[model samples]
Target chain A: MSWEKVFFALLIFPGLLYAVPTAWLMLWLERKFRARMQGRIGPPFYQPFFDFVKLMAKRRVLRPSFDSIFMMGLPLVSVSAGLLALALLPISSDSRGFAGDLVLLVAFLEVPSLCSVLAGFASRSIFGQVGATREAILSITYNLPFLTAIVALAYSAQSLRLVDIAASPAGGVRALAVLTICLCLPVKLRINPFSVSNAEQEIYSGPATEFSGPQLAMWELAHGLEWVALTGLVVCLGLTFRTGTWIGDFAIYTSLSLVLVILLTILATGTARLKIQQAARFYWRWGMGLSLVALILGVFPDIERFIR
Target chain B: MNIFSVLLKNLRMGPATLRFPEEVPYPKGFHGPVKIHTEKCICCGMCAYVCVSGAVRVAEHKDNCEWVYSPGLCTFCGKCVSVCPVEALHMAAKSAPSYFNTKALDEVHLVPYSPCPECGRPTPPVREVLRAKAFKGVAPNVLVKSLICQRCRQKDSQRALVSIQVKGEPPPSRSDK
Candidate 1:
């Protein structure tokens, strides 16, 4: 068998099963961590699974004149898009698609966000309307800073391919790229401040409000896979790896996943939610602007060289 | 002001719901319903008399042979216990009392009177002093006692009919005790 075929098959298996427990696990962990930080005991690890089952058993009732097919298709798209993103990302240097262009990776990342907006629009709920608006605004906000960081890295490396970027010299503005990526972490995870799409206080889970039964479960599963995919992208793009064996791949991916989960939980517990406008303003005014200046400074490495 | 304070506020106020299936300690100053012991009650109306809250009421039903305490009106005050001639009305220390509505709040009962076997009348005491006894901390108009006039008590001993005791203290227990 060809190496690419083996890698592709390997990726498919993990991505497909990723949603099964990942959804329940992330939800339970988030609740548990938040509870402990607040001096209480939260629900058990199985709580999310039980909740999914309960919601599934409820009678499937749609609103009058609602598009059932559109609503149903959106969640399926979310799950598949997230899984596809996971499969496309390079797990290690040896993995297939590591040679893929940075722009292709960006395109893959956009799919899940697109799915989120589509789900909101498809539901035809007022909350979904609000969610879709906020989500679109969020896309406009973070996608800039996020894309800028990737572009800065790509520019410095002199290649659009992710594997080539990893192969580049580490002496340039690599550290700056890493910092910006870390700051963008919350947005990519759909956490606080930028989490207006799922604002429970304002719109009662927004796009997810009307979605019950298996559809809700699928959406939640897609969310978890997105978390995993984002973390994998971060690890693949920047971190140096020593992967000679399958065990090494497993250990690295697992540790990275845990770190991302912990980072998100802490951020969620510690931060207050931001208004839609505040989120837009922060990303546009300060976050994206700071990174842009960093990118510009990084590219023209020295007027200082001439001055000195 | 800073991220730390904001986080602290969110953490403290956020939904960190408690685990159920295990008993939780009652919050401070939680007042549960008052308890009354029928055997120890001296029927002294002191609980009703001293009760400034008007939570206690006592009345007489003539046909029954016992005094009925409407614990619904009884406050958790030890005052009723303190004033009882025979220490009959004692408040139990169990404090958890959960209910669906406000009506559940004032409806506990203790009956000292029993219905007559022959006429179903709540038998009344022979002496005026004994008949005047009321559960402590109960309301004035809701106690179970004699409803027929003194003349009716004297004239009709055999054919006397029992009426529902609707006066004095209201029962504190909403459900059957």
Candidate 2:
């Protein structure tokens, strides 16, 4: 690809422009769906946009002890990582994918959480410190099962390239790996049951307590972009069907993303927030157990063949 | 609770959101903004006195009285509406739309006043004073007598007492008869 085309792909298509809006839509969908389930009229469709703008327009306030550079830079890093991860995903047959991009994708996915830890530490607030500590603990607890699930999927495809794994035919092992992904997703995204790091009631927005104005706006935007990237990962891994045309394939991918968002929203609404220790224990026990089973199943081709 | 059943039921019932701004039909008896009928206002300052938040201000100037309603400070308690003797104040079904500017929520109603007949001192708006007198069931002559300033009314009462003592309680006046 030409430099210009690459830049366009990274900055516009399947990048910031695309991911940000989709992420905002996911936020709206989450709120609206929860409201409907509870028999209440939710916010308007443009509410997310309004919130983003309002946050951006607010005056920036920083404590004297805060490291402004680190506090502000982390969210930008998160956004870049999310966009880079999305760019690596094969939305169409012509999309770029290098060997071992699955590992890169996983690294990119974890960078945002790492950034959150750094941001919390830099904020110099007690709540931020506590939030950072919780996030750091969560990262360690959730990363193992999340990586194991990906490894299991890679083992099933017998390739480390995302496109190859996605294009490969469905199998029993891949299905099990997909199930493991589903179980781990809530923890990774910090959905209701696993949202200990930023529990608003307990920690007051946790890492985000001290962030204000445009810096906070950027953090929220990064969060939205992260949602798109993660949901896209699930779509690529689980569905992965193509119609031989880029447009048709993208349409299928978009629909799969929508379905995943709806499913995630339902899961989020149905559960209560788990304490940090509870979340850690749950991930270590059930999440690890499921991914391990899927991993063992992926290792044995004969069993998958028999099951199919 | 089974989440799937809830989800299915909601889906069947359709979306719960109202298309607001276009179709926001306020519920019946909704305690929204307080409405003031300027013509019926008695300028008794009762609404302002009862307003716990001080959202309603009755300013009496030399020549005029100003009634200011600050919707921003209002808690929608409906106390002012209930306390209004002339039934001028009411809770409207429509609420004041949220404004980006604070000044937009302030409403000022200016009413001109009349001077007391005896002392020529400025009083509250003539229409409101008359309305209040009529609401209190005062006869026309007594209503006219009430329009004088407090000092002037005391002087007149003292003069009447002096005349009664001097004339040894003469026969009732024509109007009384």
Candidate 3:
């Protein structure tokens, strides 16, 4: 691969330049959708962007050495992981992905959660530690199905590279895997019903309780990028459409992500937050059931045909 | 109702909230700006007396009294409205009108003084409401007596004292001692 092409992939289309603005817009759109669902006039279109600027303009407060270090470093680390994952996803079918790129994408996706857990512990606060512990537990809980779904998709395609996965036509097994991934998105994004890790009421914003000023802004940016990465992954998987040009595919990707945003917002607005135990139970039962079925069908292709 | 149905209804109903720049409907008995009924005022200065913020000023002139109220300075405490002996001052039920300049928001009501009946001096005119209140149980002559200026009333009292004759035995006086 040429360095110029790699540079274009990392910093231009589907990179930081395109992803940042789209991330902010998606965040705004989700909030707007939630507001409309609740019969209220939501924020203006520029709210998320304005919020980032406002937060960045605030004065940074100094803290103890231990809490200080993580506060400075963790958001950078977390956001980098999210950005890298976004760049790796095959939003367009022409992405030059290699073997085991799916596994690498999954690893990059997990880094933010790991950083959040570490950030919580480093805060040296009761609420933060509780949040960190919940985050760790939820990570494990959600990953069971989350990883299994990706594995199932990889198995169905018979290749671990995202480009090959995109090349593979979706089947009944792939359909089940998509459903399994959909079930995990709410938890992955910290939306209600699965937001136990950062329960604002119970745990005071969870791991992010102590963050303020520009650090908090970074956290918010990371979250927005996470939206793009995770939803983009789903969109890339479920609707593998090619419209001749990358721009057309990019447009389709954006439109599908917004549609996904609306769906998630509805789910978030409808349900109250579940307790950590209840969330764990939910995943272990329904989520695990779907993932196991998909994995089983992938291992033995005869089962799906028998069911049909 | 189920959340999905509620969401659908909300989607259909639009927002129940008032939009930005739209004025909220005033509630009943909301305390608004101070307004004066010029004719009913007796120039007693009670509103001015009770005004903590000095929003109300009663300027007494020989020919007239100017009742000036600055809504910009008003704290909307409703004290002036409550203490007006002659129910002339009242709080408006609606919001105060917008003003380009706070200096122009001063409301001046003229309380003209009529010439006194007994003495030709200009005296603050009392309202009929005050008249009926003060002379509630008295006869018609009291109305005539009350309308005279204060100086004339004092002179009449002195003259009445001079005309009265002594009726009792005199006590031992210092001069006799």
Candidate 4:
């Protein structure tokens, strides 16, 4: 097969199929993981699918004053953007992998979150308004450190192509850039310390309170896909140990992804939600500082050579 | 010491939350409502007076005895039954009284009292329940009286006998009066 066909078959098609179950599975797994951490028995594996079916059977009741059109539009766009971003990630050496430039992938990954803020804002309730503001602030703060780290890597590699960057010189400045991306995963996924927007206690599920029935299901599906996609992206950035074979690469990548998912799920369960301002402060002070240091390390090859 | 204690404490679990609507059992000591044994009440106002929650309201009209019980205010203390001179009150384990309005809590009942057919004496409800309990094993069937107060017993007896002697049958006594 030609490289273009290989890319479409390997990355885009599998990525699309992978997005559905991965999102659905992550949601069920998250509930189960969270329950285990909190010393409770959570729902079963098919719980998320059951929840979607149950929601589909439910009647939708919109508040008279709510902006129904915008509320309906938000979740659909969010999940589509997440799945599209997943399609852009290069999980294997394939034809369609080059379709998504790293910059474009980053922009697509952010669309769902941006739409979340819009969803919250359109509801016009006090809680919804506050939640939208929080989501907007968090998005800006987390994405800054994230994009800075990505740009630093892109600068060093001389290519915004994700596969090309992945195939770059291993165990060098590129390696640190890859690690920085790994650090960025949890923030993009909006796990603890960064989970100010959807904190259940402080905001009553915040941006998602007014979301119910099918719209709510879409948001949940997006969240699940986003989880697996972020983890897959981390693995794609050359964080694997393979013997130059497809089977070896697949085994290594899948194992590493599973490990990363487990670690993050544990972290999510262990931590409590922080205030919005506290989260912003954390991202600005520590998150930005660490990512900047990584970026600086990735840029200064002479320093790396001198140290070696 | 601290580390071991912390580990042990974390290992210890919180109160188990009951599975609602399925594995849930009724709570202990669930005294739902007050039941009246009409013959046992003496109209002494003791139940009304002694009740700290004021759950029971008793009013003795000229011809009728009235009893009002508020299930909401009643903590199910069972104090009213204990203080009842005539043993009129019994704790209803099942059948709780419930309503949307607070005013609906006031449910009044008119207790039935049996006076003696011959003597016309009032029979206390407590004594009757106790008698029923005591004699159930001994007597296969027992007819108990629950009408007329203790004072009217002799008058009713004399009037009955006199009517039978004069009319060669029983006569109605003081129909208007």
Error of 1 at A174 (Å): 2.8
Q: Score the docking of each candidate (DockQ).
A: 0.22, 0.27, 0.65, 0.10
Alpha-carbon shift of residue B110 in model 4 (angstroms): 12
Quote the lDDT for B126 in model 1. Answer: 29
TM-score of each prediction: 0.71, 0.71, 0.84, 0.72
Error of 4 at A145 (Å): 1.3
lDDT of 4 by residue, A141-257 (tens): 777777877877676777888777776666455665566566666667777756777767778877888888888887888788788778877787756433566566666666677
lDDT of 3 by residue, B1-177 (tens): 798999988988987788667878889888999999988887899899999999999999978899999998899999988888789978888877788898678888898887888888988887778888876666565557678777887887666555553434443222211
Give the true-contact fraction for every prediction, in order: 0.32, 0.39, 0.81, 0.00
Q: A79-181 in candidate 1: lDDT tens per residue?
A: 7777666666555556544454477667877877787787788788899888887888888888888878888888777777776776666644666676667
**lDDT of model 3, residue A145:** 90
Q: Which is better, 1 or 2, measured by lDDT? A: 2
lDDT for B105 (candidate 2): 81
For DockQ, candidate 1 versus 3, the one ahead is 3
- Model 2 per-residue lDDT tens digits across residues A161-257: 9889888888766777777777877877878888898998999988888898888888888888778888888887888577879678778887788
Worst-scoring 10-residue span by lDDT in model 3 chain B: B168-177
For model 3, the superposed segments whose C-alpha errors exceed 4 Å read A123-130, A201-204, A240-244, B43-83, B95-116, B119-124, B157-177
lDDT by residue for model 4 (B14-128), tens? 3244455455555666576787866566666788898888888887664556888888788787888888755777887665645788778578877644455546444433365
Give the B-chain TM-score of model 4. Answer: 0.49
In order, what lDDT does every prediction score? 0.66, 0.82, 0.87, 0.70
